[model samples]
Target: MPDYSFLNLSPAEFEVLTRDLLQKELGLHLESFTSGRDGGIDLRHSRSRKREVIVQCKRYTGFASLKANLEQEVEKVKKLKPERYIICTSVGLTPGQKNQLLTLFNPFILAPGDIFGRDDLNNLLSKFPEVERSHFKLWLSSTEILQRILHSKIYNQSAFEEEKIKETVRLFVSNDSFGDGLKLIERHRYLLISGSPGIGKTTLARVISYHYLANGYEDFIFLSGSIDEAYSLYNADRKQLFLFDDFLGKTFLHLKLGRNEDERIIRFIERIAKSDNKLLILTTREYILAQARLSYEVFEKPAIRLANCILDLEGYTKQVRSKILYNHIFFSNLDQAYIENLLEKSSYQRIIAHKNYSPRIIETVLENISTIRPEEFVSKFIGYLDYQDSIWKHVYESQITPFSQLILANLLTAGTPIAMNDLELLIRAFAERFASKYGIVYSQIAFNKAITELENTFIRSSRDSKDKLVIDYANPSIQDFLVTYLNDLQDMMGDVIDTACFFNQLVSFFAYEGPGTPSQRPRRTHLAVTPYLATKLVNRLTQNFVELPSSTLKKRLNSNTEPYYYQVRRSVYNKLNFLRHSNLYTNNIAMRNFTLEFFKLIMIPNHVQSEDIGHYVSLVIYFHNEIPFEEEKILAALAPNIETLSDYHDFKQLEALYTETYAKFISKSAAYKEAVRQMVDWEAENVDTLDIRDFVDDIHAIVDHTKIDLANVIIDLEEKFQERDRDYDPDEIYDHDEDVRSEYRAEEENISDMFDSLK
Candidate 1:
């Protein structure tokens, strides 16, 4: 039996619940009307043209209030003179009160059961358990279930407030994804939810997690740092669930998994699959997951393919989308005027049909309605739908403090999940350099206060696997908003570079023109570096090369005690790479000459590593006809390290150099042939443990050049795969793609028909 308070529902929702309950109890379809002055007809049923049954629903918290409201409704009920009248109220009714109500609407209300009270509704729900479960808010908001949910350790791990969860449940509209996700998790004990940004992956994950928690699951763990945390907390004796949100990463730069992280995650999935008491849920952007499969071999396994549950726009049908919009509008703080504008002329239908519709953008636009006038809400809302990217612009510009903005900019410049200590150091450095420009006083107290202010909004803090605190964007869209915001402000870009404490920040945040530059660099994607800004960056680099503070360089170093050797090496490589391709560095005589002097001072002493020698070679080769470095000088500096290069990437670089004007010189060298042979031998020896997909291209290139035989390695790889296939069971394979497509089509058709009736 449910001791449902029914306080979680709005007046409209309570009416719908009552209609649903009575329709089941009476075994007849009840027609409901739009919310307004109902004239004593909340729901209606007709057996013939002359016979009509009318229901009036009142959601009241006190019996006195219900009785008083009923007195007013008696006259309205008499005007139509229905064949029967029914009353439903959330307020409990005593026998005396029911008898008095029966006397007031005498003939219409013929029996006590004709007037349903709070206890009567509960009893009906007990009779129809399915109806109770269907009304999720009714059962979930019950005091007993809420206590069980909130007091659980899992709720504490996520830091979700009780009221916040209630609000989330109120606005959430269940779709095919929820049912599909539960079935997937039940079968495999693990689920991977992937979709584009703002497509409700995180929300779906939370809803499913809460569902399991409401059931018998005793513990819920949020894996914020590493898969190892899941393993550390696994208990085979008790039911447990784990969630690793954004498991691959949120941004492209952070997509590369940590050392063997892919392998650890796969192993953990296998472990969870073997246990009946455990479940794991992971979410990532769909594109990020594709990139991960390309970068990490373990993600390409068949098990991971089976666990994927993709949430796409097709999964959100017209009716579900309408319900989502209605819930948000009903629960929002907007006044009736604004709501009316949104609902006028079926304006909401345009929003649902818009190409750029997303749940996050809708929420963001509604949450910031105070920024727009009531008359302008529909136009501005459609404008937000059209642009979509500017949804965060108003809140970011006007809502946050300037110090907090600087902290977010620094976080964006530094990349995310930065060590808390490292972020504080960068913040202190930024404040010391630029606080006066913004009219802010620099203090440790202010820095801490800024971080605190930004938490759970623009940024979030969590401990890594080592229990060290780190900070990252609360949502990936924040990173997107900041990138666009910063790209438009050249002066701010300069400020970030000028106050950068690490050399990597310059490399990470900006790029010089070159064939070697990454396609995803800021210049191509977000920031357009003006010549003035480029010149500023070059000047900063040169000054840092000459007079970089020891403490600053020490803070930048990561577990290396080479005292500034690596920093100097990185500076030389970046400068030479820039000079080779950048028009400003090559055509501007002063900048070119200044960079050449720094390069000579750094490179003439043989400071380059074997891995970085390719950059040096590219510089000299690209400028062999333009610059005047002796060929012998370049070869003498690089020849001693040719035998030490063991990886295929190193050999690939050397091969590129060999095919250039240096082909005859490098082809005739004995050390170059030995390096190629050693790389081939290493691959052959590790074929059993390596992914052939990773090295197949390298092997083909090596074989084309050296004519080395790798047939035995290929045979060994084929034999291993064949043996595994022989051991696999065909019956265990689940074709999720076909089944999901069929289910989606059916759900869309069903919902389309159902929504037509409401309209």
Candidate 2:
């Protein structure tokens, strides 16, 4: 609908258009046209009625504030007394660049932003808008060695592979959270994505760009730094998807730009990104982790988020990795037996075998794969651990960095003490899930040693407190510091961890049950404790406990101790009575069963938050067989209380300090909606009962609803906020000193009185 084709104009084509307009309209004749010289202009003018115009053209994607440079060049041409001077840029100058251009007071025309004032220039730009549509809308399928790779059909290469890849995509997309990102993309007017290096940023970008291109969408133009090679892509004619890989041209974060000239470039790109309906997709590998929380300033965060769409690219999970492997091998000689053997034996080789696997290392490995070069293929695998041998050679040789510390900060967030058993359990559990993506060996020792460091660094224990380990998750600064240093040498640290617990758990599981999909794996309660589960437990208690009235809890406790610190009192147990009827009480049942069998217990995760719901839904459908009215009622009753949760209770009394945390149930509606939809779709369609329902169609329905809902919610909230602010009178609220809302004098008196009391 919008004309976003800015990349279709060539310098010569633009020059011709301008020259033809001048000649036809003004009856001006030129002897010859000459362009592009290092310095000094060459112009042959035989006509006297029409003035000779000297032009400088700059075509670029990076910071395009060349207006000052153009002005200087114009001044140089002025000294020559050239009758006219013109500057044309592929992208355009910023407001400041245009202001600088106007300051010259030269008798010349500046096209685009410089020539047209603000809205006028943007209005002109609106004539040729950028693409803001889906890849499917463009009918463009994947171009990522799609034909070549699919022809080989490596993952299903032998035969009947299409079905397998489809199955793989289904499996990968099954994790409801995995695709939450796509909603942001489709719902917004502007979006930016940033992630750690080698997280499939470019691959996701390529998939997005090429998919749109193949769909016959003409309102979009694709551009990357590589597109610069085309030379004619910056014209106002090209508008579609612009997939830029390795954008944000500045290299190191701390390093300063070479000259003032650098600022000009930044100014240029800022204008392009700020423009409406124009999608500029970019990728970068390096960004500070502190930039995780999105901010108002566009530059503050490494990622993009605007009115349009913003989808982040997190790398493949265990399911995705297995699917990828299957897809790749299926195309070639990877037979199901060989595939199963590889699947069974091959563990995830971390891109950062020493740290974390980044998409670049993954891409580098895959890109170099060749039938002729087995060693190269091996090198790619080894490269996943490149830093171990190369970057952190000594650390690996010595095995000194604490492995727990590496992933600890990331692991611990709920303000609770980190338990050794729980920490070990988390590491093993996570490793197994995406086992093949990162080359992590199962270890319990690393978990234990890391626990020692945790004790030394942040752990505090008191005899009076239940669970004894006092850890505050709210203080993320310390966690941030640890995560940074630890991830830097994760490879060296991994070896330091003890694998006994990891191996023992595996042995126990093998003794009882065989390894396979989710259900086939050892049930969590049967294995060692995990920190993720521990945190989930803490969060869950926060939810349920906070919901209970503090007055009743205070009466129950009857002592000067936090409620959570006390043994399971009547206050908490009585509340559980309300929960037992719901299926979400799985963890509750497990906890009761455990305490009944043993004596004391730790925390348990709510059914609402856990990924177990996917498994739960599967079980429900399998048992029901057909979706009868009674079955629907049973399913509805058991559905995660995500949207139904209306009340949020506060544990703190008198005057409560406030912070917001969403109820897991309240936040999971979108994910749960898809989960339920997929369950229904799975029941409706023919899905292999052997594998969990990988229902694509129902998943799309959920995705579409999510996107629409997000867009509507964001827009609606923004409108209401704006409308509410419209009648605001700031002066009226400047607050009279007697307003009493100000607690300054009272607080000051309290402070003095408290000091006197201490005396």
Candidate 3:
């Protein structure tokens, strides 16, 4: 007999199968099966109005072992007084088991072939392809469908439950939004549902897809984070519904997309709007979608604007949350004590009002209800909800292997998918370089095994359109948790220096050697590290370095950051904020002393953004008030390019530095004496008597001082302006004096002539 064990049908699922088989295959009018009152009769069938048959279904896999259940079912069937009856089971019965059952019923009621078993069910399924396709859909699905469903189910088990999906959807207690969403998609041809993490956007999309699938739309496809694949799945000729979950991106913090990906997505949606037979539905985190609106501006396009319908799932009512919690509790297998405890008015209200209450959180909490003590259940549930980071940390610490943890660290650090080949290279490279520090070694095969272990939990591997196995965190929060955990690990580990070295290597790898660029060899794959992740790793290094003693921080700070210039700048900016408020940091002689050198290292621009250049300069000047820099220190900080500097606040601070530096310089030393002498010479050669003030103003303009700096520079400059004639060449000075006298004598002669002529 064919093995139907792969079906793994539950009791309820088996009944659904039997009901469909009788009505679809047997061509009989049958009564529906009702739960809790089936009375051993799953169905009553009538054929040709003259013959009436009774049917019974037992989902038992071991018919021989369950003889008692069979006998009891037989007794219940006998009371129905049916002229004919058939016993259907998922497993075949032995001759002894069949003979015992045969003896229990009347000969007219039961015959030798009256019992149907696995072989019989297989044959029936073979005969009716439609029934197999619908009822045993998973077993009958094509490999592509099976793989897609299996892969998606690993990150989310909803796809598995989808096979035996109950009429009542769990976790999503309300259908009102789903109904409205469905109508919007149907009417507009496109819909984008946006919401927070774990707010049931995906669930509502699933329900909508399943509804269309039920309505005879055969080409249902799902895509996540890839518009090219979604475009490939689009079939305009057939009636279909396409679902693109998190289409804008996942991980709001690191939403790095392929170039022009947003444009392609907008174009795809525009195409869908024109197609009458095809429908599109998309979902994304609300903040991410909002960012997309700002970044892509696709929603502003007239065609897309008209076709788009956004449903935001925020501010869920308390009643809705309560209902959601109850739904999860109802479906999950919690102990009676736990269930009763959760049902208590106070316990129910506590979860409903908890700040962290969400559909996904509720599912996670209730699924582990069996492990929690009944007495501690309520408090623990609230605790887990309140601190989801703790839960993620525990999951990471408990479920992951050492090598797998390293891989996850890399993935989180990389901030995007690492292809299998590229991931192998990264693992091998890190092991060879830092094996002594992290205390582990991994061969390629061992690395493969480790990743296999993490397949569905911390990391997920999926084939992109190129058919490369790209690995990423199962979700964005997983990445966030791992990054945070690794930063904490930097402090907790005993080998602090080695760990710092390890993080530096990680920083370097992402900064330069990371993926996303094509290799020199044809067909060779490389994963490019995202800029966000590279910046994050550098930031991590800065964070680690700041906690170390002054000696260590200075030692690391002295190293050349030329290769990772931009990232180092951002990291330093972040550190400046961290150290800005702490008196401990502010007072530390080492940090205070190293402040100028640290600022100089990060301020050195290597193709950094213009705005960032301003930011770096600002960090130094803002902290200058506390760090106490001299004239040279001000010049050193301002020595880098300032034309690109645009931040007004930092600009104001930069002005303050110049003004304060000039004031101190004039009082303490003749720093500006030479420049002042040159300014005086220029004014004498270029100016007439009337233009002397203009020449003095020109000297002020040439100095390039701010309003604040001008006041102090001008005070010393005015005296120098009066004495400019002495500093000029002696002939130039004497000639200018003689010309002044000649002009005065000429004006006197004119006045005398006028007076004599008037007399």
| Highest TM-score against the true fold, candidate | 1
Q: Give each model a TM-score.
A: 0.69, 0.25, 0.47
lDDT of 3: 0.54
Per-candidate local distance difference test: 0.67, 0.34, 0.54
**Highest lDDT scorer:** 1
Ranking by lDDT: 1, 3, 2
Q: Tens-digit lDDT track for model 3 on 733-753?
A: 112222211110000112111
lDDT of 1: 0.67
Off by over 4 Å in 3: 1-171, 250-256, 300-303, 306-308, 443-449, 462-468, 487-759
Worst 10 residues of 2 by lDDT: 646-655
Residue 732, candidate 1: how far off, in angstroms?
A: 11
